[model samples]
Target: MIQEIKPAIWQILGKQPGRNVVIIGGTHGNERTGVEVVSKLKSMIESGRLNIIRGTLVLIHGNPRAIEINERGSEPHADLNRSYLVDLLEREPTGIYEDQRAREIAPLLIVSDVVVDLHATNKPSEPFIACADSSGHEQVYQWFPSKKVLSDPNYVLAGKLVTTDEFVDAHGGTGLCYETGQAGDVTRVDEVMRNVINLLIDQNLVEGEVRIPSNECEIYEMIEPIVLTAVGFTFAEGFGNGSWEPFVADQTIGYHGDVPLVATYDGVVVFPKIQELRKEGSPLAYLAKKVNERKKPPRD
Candidate 1:
């Protein structure tokens, strides 16, 4: 049976501990790839197919109730992933369900050496890794050879709770958001889950034979993520993953009515929203680079 810590943090502790690698899934409730992956890993360990090394592998089910309903909001209709900022916790305290969940998991993350949070997008797109502008970026990039890397330099928004890239930077450990594919797609989920498990083993977090991808996938270094607000409207209905070609220098992609939401620099689109939600704004898209093209790729 899976072990529970409070209502959000769950773990399957190994026989011994040395280094610690935390794998978090279902942070968004609807995105279930990481959850399934963790479950499978636990089964392997219990059945003696996989072995724990010098470190402990902790599988955190981010939002259990949300996963059960397959919606972004947990039981209290809060986005758990965006609930990590310290101020938010102190202010409202129990304003949202995600806030409470963050309180429970923050301490657990503080002690981890490496954290990988798995996610699935609403639109179909290739798998990629997201990291903050911190030393950990180098480590995580080298750990999981992705086709692209999304590096955001902005101060992480306080609203994003537990798995924010900022927390990883603050703690001096590598933190990554692995976007697998469209929500609830088992095929894509399996592909990402297998990759994550293999990544842990390859990085020496666990003791097992895990295959790392031979060819690195495309890498996208996000210079900036255009945040949507009430005033602007993303050109809906036509946008889908890989729908548009990589933006050319100073090319326009969308408009706030007449104002152009152009690409200041050229890169591929990563997360384009297709579904409607309660929130007015969403990530319009991201700029990225192919991994091989980077001047200096992230290293261990």
Candidate 2:
């Protein structure tokens, strides 16, 4: 049976208890694919087309207020996707829409066995997966078709846990973020939906014949996120537009004012910030190098 847990959160319980799974959409309100995916799942379940067979399935509309206005976030200071930090979740309400929303959603994440936070980039790009290296994380990501995986073992993204998947991982759960290309594109909705359904089946949360897809992936260990400096930063030339761009050792990446930002090693730059999204102290872009193999975290 499916029941509304909150304004934009719903819980579907199976007769046989199992893993607690939370699938979040609209975390960044402008990411339409996730929002649409959750909406479609709700409709499918409500209309008797989909079934939850053995576990609790939670569907969350991550930032309803921002989603209502069709913006990345409702507040200027807080990003819902980055508001899940421990301090923020444990503190008294800050009156910021996204911060307060994170507080409301923390409990669900605390109890989740698996979390799939759907997202999309602001600029055009191919789909990719981001998560820490772990056995649990590996279990889910293999089901997706994305060939590139960013493994952040040292928390270079924000210097600490902030994203939904990161928070989930902190509490000993499998968490992953699926970037479904650009926010405005909906071409992959059906494909993404099918992938999630297949995941549910594999986990025994839904009944079906599970056909696990290829697990081969080009793993990249995240080196660091290049923070926009006070003097401001800019990609050297023809870079930082979007997607992945490769650079050789000692090559000039961009400029921090008049100072040249040079690459330390051969790697690919992913998730380059467009001009509008660039902010002092925020990530302008992130660097990663292809790894020979992934190192899984020790099981608890």
Candidate 3:
């Protein structure tokens, strides 16, 4: 039976006392790839095919109700991801569905040494990893090499949960968000899940073959976000995933009749969800760079 929480489901695997690796999937209900990946991993571990080397593996379905309905958020359409870092029970006295789940999972998240929040984008693109903390980015890269790593401080702040970030900061552990691909990409889903399992093994948290590459590609970071506004006459035709070309500063990206929506910053266009019917404040793309000391200063 699916272990049920208020608006989520969770399964604990290999409950040994060693390293802790927590895998969260379906944070955005519509992103089915993560849900499938987490389910598969849970099944593998339960069947005795996958074993934990030293520590434990925690698999969580972040938004079960949303996943069931195949929508972005829970029944009331509240994003469960944004619900973290706050006292949900007190804030929403009526008890929002996602808020309840957040309260229940917060403790588990706080105790975890490593966290991998799996998600799928609305647009079709190559798999990429998003990390807020520089140290966390490095640790994740060492485990599972990504095609690109967006590591802008502002982007990190914009995409991070304050409570979750605090937990990682306190533990000096890594927390990463993996965007496998657009929802329903089974091939990429399997690939990312396998890589994540291997990472758990390599970190000595699980009992399995450690797959490491002799030479790994460098990870790229985002310097700035390509912000889209509601006032702009940006008519996105078709699904704009990674199809948009590199944009130089002051170049015209789209037109509001005769007015041009010029590029405010110089960076490659990434994750442009043209078909997305979400709000205008949503991120269009970002310019990234490598996570290094030069980019991130030492914290006191």
Best by lDDT: 2
lDDT of 3 at 129: 70
Candidate 3: lDDT of 198? Answer: 76
lDDT of each: 0.64, 0.85, 0.63
Q: Which pairs clash in the backbone of model 3? A: 52-207, 53-206, 53-207, 221-288, 221-289, 222-287, 222-288, 222-289, 223-287
Per-residue lDDT of 68-155 in model 2, one digit per residue for the tens?
8888898654588778886665577767878888988988998899999999988778899998766678788877778788888888
Model 1 whole-model lDDT (C-alpha atoms): 0.64
What lDDT is obtained when candidate 3 is compared to the true structure?
A: 0.63
Report the C-alpha lDDT of model 1 over 75-169, residue by residue, as the tens digit: 54377777766444356586566777777777777778878888877777666677763444655555454566565554322224344555755
| Model 1 CA lDDT for position 83 | 73
- Per-residue CA lDDT of model 3 for 14-132, tens digit only, reads 44667777788887788887888888887877687777757666788877778888877776437776666534434644478777767777666767778888876666766667665
Clashes of each: 20, 0, 9
Candidates in order, TM-scores: namely 0.80, 0.94, 0.78
TM-score-superior candidate, 1 or 2: 2
Question: What are the runs in model 2 whose C-alpha is more than 4 Å off?
Answer: 87-89, 293-300
